[model samples]
Target chain A: MSGDLTARSGGLTLPRIGDRALWSFVGRRIGHAVLVLFCVATVSFFLVRISGDPVRQMLPPDATAAQETALRAQLGLDQPLLGQYVSYMTGLLHLDLGQSLFFHRPAFDVIAERLPATVTLAAGALVVVLVVAIPAGVVSALRRGTATDTTVMAAVLVGQSAPAFFVGILLILVFAVNLQMLPASGMGGIENLVLPAVTLGLYSIAMVARLLRSSLVDVLGEDYIRTARAKGLTGWRIVTAHGLRNASLPVVTVVGLEIGNLLGGAILTEQVFAWPGVGRLTVEAVTYRDYPLMQATVMFLATVFVVVNLLVDLSYAALDPRVRLS
Target chain B: MPVLEVNDLHAEFRLDTGTVRAVNGVSFSVEPGQTLAVVGESGSGKTATALSILRLHPTPPCVYTGGEIVAGGRDLLTLPEREMRQVRGNEIAMIFQDPMTSLNPVKTVGAQIVESLRRHRSLPRGEARARAVEALREVGIAHPEARAGQYPHQLSGGMRQRVMIAMALACRPKLLIADEPTTALDVTVQAQIMELMADLQDRFGMAIVLITHDLGVVAQVADKVLVMYAGRPVEAAGADDLFERPRMPYTRALLESMPRPDVPGGAVLDPIRGAPPNLLDLPSGCAFHPRCGFARPECASTVPALEEKAPGHAAACVLTDDDLPGTSEGRRVSGT
Candidate 1:
C-alpha cells in the first residue's frame, strides 16, 4: 500500500525550476515596467501640450509679435506639433528634458535639485508608517474585539478619513504654533521633516494598519495557526514566525503602492509646509506653464510608480511561493 | 498506568444564541504503546474531545465546564496555560485532519520541524537541522535534504501528511493525538499514512489517540475503540469485540453502514436515517433515541449509562443481550 501511494504521488511531484527561471522572471517584470513607463510618458506629453501654450504664459501681454515669434523660435515652440514631439523624444533619448522656462535651467537639473527633499519626506513618512502601523495592526489583530482593538481601529478610521491638508495644518497648529516643539514649514533639521511626514503618512499608516489587521486576523484563524499552537509554540513565536510572515505579504504590496501615492500627493503637504520638494516644483511649473519642468516631474513620478509596483510584485513573489511570475 | 486519562470531560461553546454542549461527560484513557480510536460522525464531539485535551479551542467561544485530563498524573484542564504549553507538542503532540492547511505555507517543512525540536529540546541550529532531516527520512520522504528546504506547496498531500507526522513525532512525545490524519488523502495515500503511523508508533513506543470517523481506519489501526454519538461515548470495547458484538443500537447501525465488498451486487448500502443531534438542542435522555431502531419508551425519557455487558465491553443502551439481534444476523435485521 505504501509503495502504491508513493508511486502514484511521485507523478504529482512539482518539477524544480532552477534559479535561471527566477532571474528570467525578474527580468521579464522589469521589461514590462519599462514598457508601462513609456506609455505613461507618451500620454502625459501629448496631454500636457494640449492643455495650453507655455510660450504665451511665459511672455508679457504687451510683447510685440516679433518678440513673441523670436521667443517661440528660440524655445522651439514655433516648430510644428510633430516636429516638437520628435525633438522631445530625441531629447529624451539623450537623457535631456529640455530647459525650464521659469528656472532658466535644464528641466531635469531643476527637478533633480528638488528630488532629494521629496525623497527625504517620502522616506521619513514610510518610516513612520512602518514603525507605527505594523505594531498597531498586530496588536489590534491579536486583541481582536477588545477595548484596545476598538480604540485603535477607531483612530485608524479617523486618520484614513481626514484630509492630508487638514491634518498638516492641524499638526502645524499643535506642534508648531501651540507647543512650538518643531518647525511648521521648510526643510532643515530632522525636526523640520516631522510635521509634513506625519501629515502625509497619517493616511498610509491608517491604510496599512487596517489592511494588516484584517489580513492578520484572517491568518490567525487559519489551520496552520492551530497547528503552530499544537506544536507547543509560544503565542508570541507563533504570531511572529508563523502568522506575521503570511500577513505581511499584502502589507508589503500596499506599502509599495503607498510610496508612489506619497510622492504624488506630497504636493499639498509640501505647499502647506513650504517644503521645496518636486511636488511643490511641479505645482509651480504648472502655474507658470513651465512645460518642460512639469512634463519632467510628472514623468519622473510615473517612472517611480512603475518601478515601485515592480518591486512590490517581486517581493510578493518572494513572500508567497505559490505566486508564479510567469 | 495510562499515558493519558480523560475523566468526565464536559466542554461547551458559549455562543450568542445559546450554549452548545460539544463534549459531555466523555471519558477514556490511552495506555502506553496502545492505540485508542475515538470514532464518530461529524459534530459528534470527537474533535472537541481531542482539542480539549490540549486546550486548543479559542477561549471566548469554548469553555471547559468540568473535566480532569490527567496526563502523567497532572490535571491538564486546571494546569496553568504556561505549563500547558510545555505539555503540548512535548508531552502530547497532535496532527490535524487536512495536511494542506495544517502546515504553514510560508515555512519550509524542515524549518517547521526544526522549530519544534529547538523549542522542546533546546538543540542548536546545526543539530536541529540534522534531526529535522532525519525525521523527514524516517517518515519515508525521498531526498530529505532537499525536501527540507521546500515549502508545503511543493509537496503532495501524502508527503505533506508524512511531514506533519514527522514533526509530531520529532520530539518523541509520549501521547500523539491524530485527528483524522488520513481523511484528506486519497485511499492509497490513506493506507500509506496509516502504515507509516503504525510503524512510527512501534519504534517510538508512544500511546496514540486516533480520532477518526472511518470504521475501516479504526479496525485497521485501533486496539480499543470508543464509539461516540452526540458528544458522548455510546460504547467502549476492544476492537474485535466491538465489531463482533456491538451492543448499542447506534454502534450496530454504524457497523452495518460500512460498505462491504463481500455483499452481492445491486444490494443497497444501509445508512443511518437521521443526522446527529444538534449540540445546542439535544433531545432528552439518550441523544440517539431519535435515530435508534431499537429505541424503547424508556430510552426516550431516561439516559442509559455505559455499563459492562461483558468483562470489558461496555455500551450505553436500554436493550439487554436478549433484546439485541445476534452478531451473525445483526446486519440483516438492522437493514430491514
Candidate 2:
C-alpha cells in the first residue's frame, strides 16, 4: 500500500449524449435560448420602428409625395402598425427577414454575406488575446511584487486605458504609414488583418491579463498550493497543473463575455480599418435606414451572444465540479 | 540517529508593520518510528516550525532568520529550492490542517495521488495509476478504484483526510508532519483519522511530528510530547511522563484543562488566564510569565532556559517542584 492518493482525474469525460439527463439539460438550455431570442426579436422590431420612416429616409428630399407613397406602398410600410407586426412575425416563421433596402437581397442574406469577415477578425483577435494575455498573466502572478509583475501590470494599464480607435490609428500610423510594412487602412489579404486584429485585441488582452493575474494571485495563496509544494512538484508544474485550473475560472468567464462583445461587430475598429465586415454593414444599414438589414444584424448578434453565454455556462460546469449543469 | 533534528530554529514574518518572530529558538528531535506532538495555542508557532522544515513558507514575508533543519545528512534550511523539492515528499512529507480545501477541486483524487507518485518515481503512466489506486486502498477507502476517480467534494471530510494521508505516504517518506490534521474533522472522524495514522505508522514505521493544540490527541498517539508556548518549546517529555509530572506551569495548565474522568468531581476546567503573548512584542522575559499563577518578579525579568528537573523531562518555567508546597501538582491545578 502506497501513500499516493491519486486524488483527482483531470479532463472531463463527456457522459453519453444518449443519456436522458444530458439531453434534458441541453433541451432546457435551447428552450431558454429560444425565449431570449424571441424577446430580442420583439424589442429590435419595435426599436427599429421608432428610428423614423425607413421609406421616407430612403427617398431624396426633393422627391415628390407620389414617389414617397409609391416606395411606402411597395415596401408595405403603408400598412397599419399591427398589420406590420403580424406580417413581420409571419415572415419570421418562414425564416425570412425582409429584403435589405440597400443590398436588395434578403436581409439575412446580406448580413450573412458580411459575417465571415467579422468572424475572421473576431477569431484572429481572440487568438491574439489568448496568446498574449495568458502567458503574461502567469508570469506576472509568479513574479508578483517584482519588477516583472509591475511592468506587465503597467503595460496592461496602458492597453486598457487606450481607446480602441486610437490604438487602431496608432497601429496604422506605425505599420501602414511610416514603416510601410502593411496597408494603413482598407481590407485586403492577411497583412491588412494583422493591424486591425491587434488593435481590436489590445484592450481585451490587457483585461484578461489583469484578471488572470489577480485570480492566480488569490489561488496561489490557497492551502492547495502548499499541498502541491509539499508533494515535491516544481513551482511551474504546480501552477500549470493545479493552480491554473482553479485560477482560470474567472478568466474563462471574462474571456467568454469578451467573445460575445468581439463577435458583435467591433464597430470602431471596422470603421477605422474600412474592413467591410458586418460592423461596417451595420453602420451603412443604420445610416441608410435599411430597417431589414438593421433588424437582421441585431438579431444575429443577439443570437451569438445568447449561444456563447450558454456555452460559457456549460464550460464552467466542465471546469469546476461544484457548478452542476442541471 | 534521529530521523529529523531541528536546532535553534527561528522563523519570522516581515510584514509591512515590523517583524513578527513567529518561531523563536525552537529545538527538538524525533527518533525513527516515534511520534513527537508539538502542542500549542494558535500563535504558539507550532505550525511555523513544521512549515519551516519543508521551507514551505512564502519567501518574502516569511523568512527563516536562523535555523538548521538537518535531514538526510544535509541542512534543509540552506538547500537550493531544486534540491529541496527532491527532499520534500520523498524524505519528509507534510499534511495540512484543512483537508477540505487542501486538495485541488478540479482534479480527481486518483490524479492527485498519481502526480505525487510520478514526482519521485519514474513509473509509466499505467503503473503510476495502479500505484495510486493501491495507495487509496491502503488508506481504507472502499472500492479504491472507483473512489480514486471521485473529487474531494464527493467524499466526506474523514475520507478526504484519508486521501491526504494516502498521497503523503505514497512516497513513503521517513517523516510525516501532520499539522493539526484532525482539527477540522468531527470528533469521531478525528479519532478514525488518528488511528489510521497510527496504523500506517506501524506498517511503514515513519517518524511523526504531530502539531496540534488538542491535548487529547497528544495523549492518544504521541510517544514524546513538546508543549509550545509563545513560539518556544516550554516543556518536553515522554507522553506518559508529561501527563503525570508536567514540570512547566503552562503544561500544567494545559493538562488541568483536559476533561478527564480521573480528575476530582469539583475540579474546575481552569482556562489559561490570558490570551497567548503577542509574538510581535513578547513580554520582557519568560513569554508566559504574565499568565502564570505563581509568577514571581524574577519570572517577569529573566528569560528562563529549558532545563531538566528530572531524567528525560524538561520545562522552561522558573519554578521547580519545590516552589509549590501542595502542588505536586495535578490535584490543585485542575480546580477552575
Best by lDDT: 1
Q: What's the lDDT for candidate 1?
A: 0.88
Instruction: Report residue B324 deviation for candidate 2 (angstroms).
Output: 3.5
Write model 2 residue lDDT over A1-326, tens digit each, in one string.
Answer: 22223333566644446767667888899999989888888899889889878887888889999999999998888889889888887888788988888888999888888888899999989999999999999999999999999999899889878988899999889888899999987777889899988988888998899999999999999999999999999988999988898999989988998998888849889999998888888899899888888888888889899889988877777788776667
Best prediction by TM-score: 2
Candidate 1 off by > 4 Å: A1-18, B263-267, B328-336
Q: Write the per-residue lDDT of candidate 1 for residues A165-276, one digit (tens) a residue.
A: 8999999999999999999899999999999998899889889998999999999999999999998899999999989988998999999999989977799989999999
Best by DockQ: 2
Q: Each candidate's DockQ score against the native complex?
A: 0.40, 0.56
Error of 1 at A36 (Å): 1.9
